[model samples]
Target chain A: MFQKTLTLVLVGVLFMGIATLTYGTFYDKGFAASVTGMMGLGDDEHGEDGDDD
Target chain B: MTKLRLPKAFELLLVWHGLLVGSYTIAYLTAEGAPVLHQFAGYSVLGLLAVRLTAALIAGVRPPWALPLPKASMWKNFGRKLAAGHFSALLGRTPFAPLSGLVILGTLVLVTLSGLAADWWEWEDLHEGLAESSLAVVLIHIAIVSFAPLLKRLNASRADAAATALPRNA
Candidate 1:
């Protein structure tokens, strides 16, 4: 019982973290730019893998 | 300790990644901008969904669990009733909720397909429309996924306790 409850809490917290990260990264246009801007390319640049030279 | 573990693990994972985390990603992606990024998320969402449905289908066809549902194993069942509450919302509320949920979920599938077309064909509204509606659909998906296990656990434990607590004479 304890184990399950603990897992439940942990999972909840883990999901909350993922949610925060997701929301923090992409909730708003400017927010996405400022955050993901620094987090680097998130499949947006397509093939801009710096091999364009 | 048995063949059941694989399918059980898949069910737990389906709830976690396919539903919970997946929905969060979908919601944020749909609500935001960047065609490329949204497409990327949309692709991932489709992939995650495929993994889940495929897993469930395969598991159902075969008796992966000693029990009826592989997800009901007591060993792996651990979670707060809060999640149970969320999962049982539709079933407990009304018979119609499942039907409605199915309709909306179908729309979500369409949203994914439409978004895919929009990505390549550059159809203006399909992209934006699907993207906009996906947030809510994803939310519902995550919620149901998150709570299903909790509900299963709750029912299991309740049955166990009820069985044990029966009077010695009765």
Candidate 2:
């Protein structure tokens, strides 16, 4: 019984890992943009520093 | 002593997956800057895991070194044995194998999830933390595998001691 439960858990984790990796790899550009934005690494055009002339 | 042998196919798959994934991770850490290659490795690992999980679910057609599934008793008695300092016996038991498998899978999931989030959502902190954790888990897994034979010997010695003591008492 416990073995069955453990198997289920293993499958669940594997599925989640696969899904996450697929998403990150296939959509690299968007992910990179969002991550950089979140880190406040956006360029001048996207930056919110409010020093526009 | 029953020789410890994992299914040949399963073992090969695991070794291949480990090499691919490990290299990619090392590249990432060392600032190799080849994002495409890293992504490709991630996809390959995802494919390999899918195949492995599918084979596990199927009946009567598992690979030669079938997946090591621990018995129910191991989880039940884990705490008691752990508290009693029976480390060698615990490690040597067939039932205890699943816990290590669980740790490996759980940490892999964390690493993948955090890596994705860091890349797409800028959660660099989460990614870095999980990356370190994944490395630690992998190292421990390797250490346990390497020490299995020594642990089995220790377990045998303990049993011998018990048998000798019983004769003296009689």
Q: Pick the candidate with the highest lDDT.
A: 2
Q: DockQ (Cα-based) per candidate?
A: 0.08, 0.04
Question: In candidate 2, what are the lDDT values of residues B1-170, reduced to their tens digit?
Answer: 88987655644555544443444343243222334434454555445555555666663345533445654677657666777886645455544454566576566666666656656897767866776677787677656654666666777999999999998899
DockQ of 1: 0.08
Q: Which residue runs does candidate 2 get wrong by more than 4 Å?
A: A1-53, B1-34, B59-69, B75-96, B150-170
Cα lDDT for residue A38, candidate 2: 27
Error of 1 at B98 (Å): 3.7
> What's the iRMSD of model 2?
12.5
Off by over 4 Å in 1: A1-53, B1-27, B59-97, B136-170
What class would a CAPRI assessor give candidate 1's docking?
incorrect
In angstroms, how far off is B68's CA in candidate 2?
Answer: 5.4
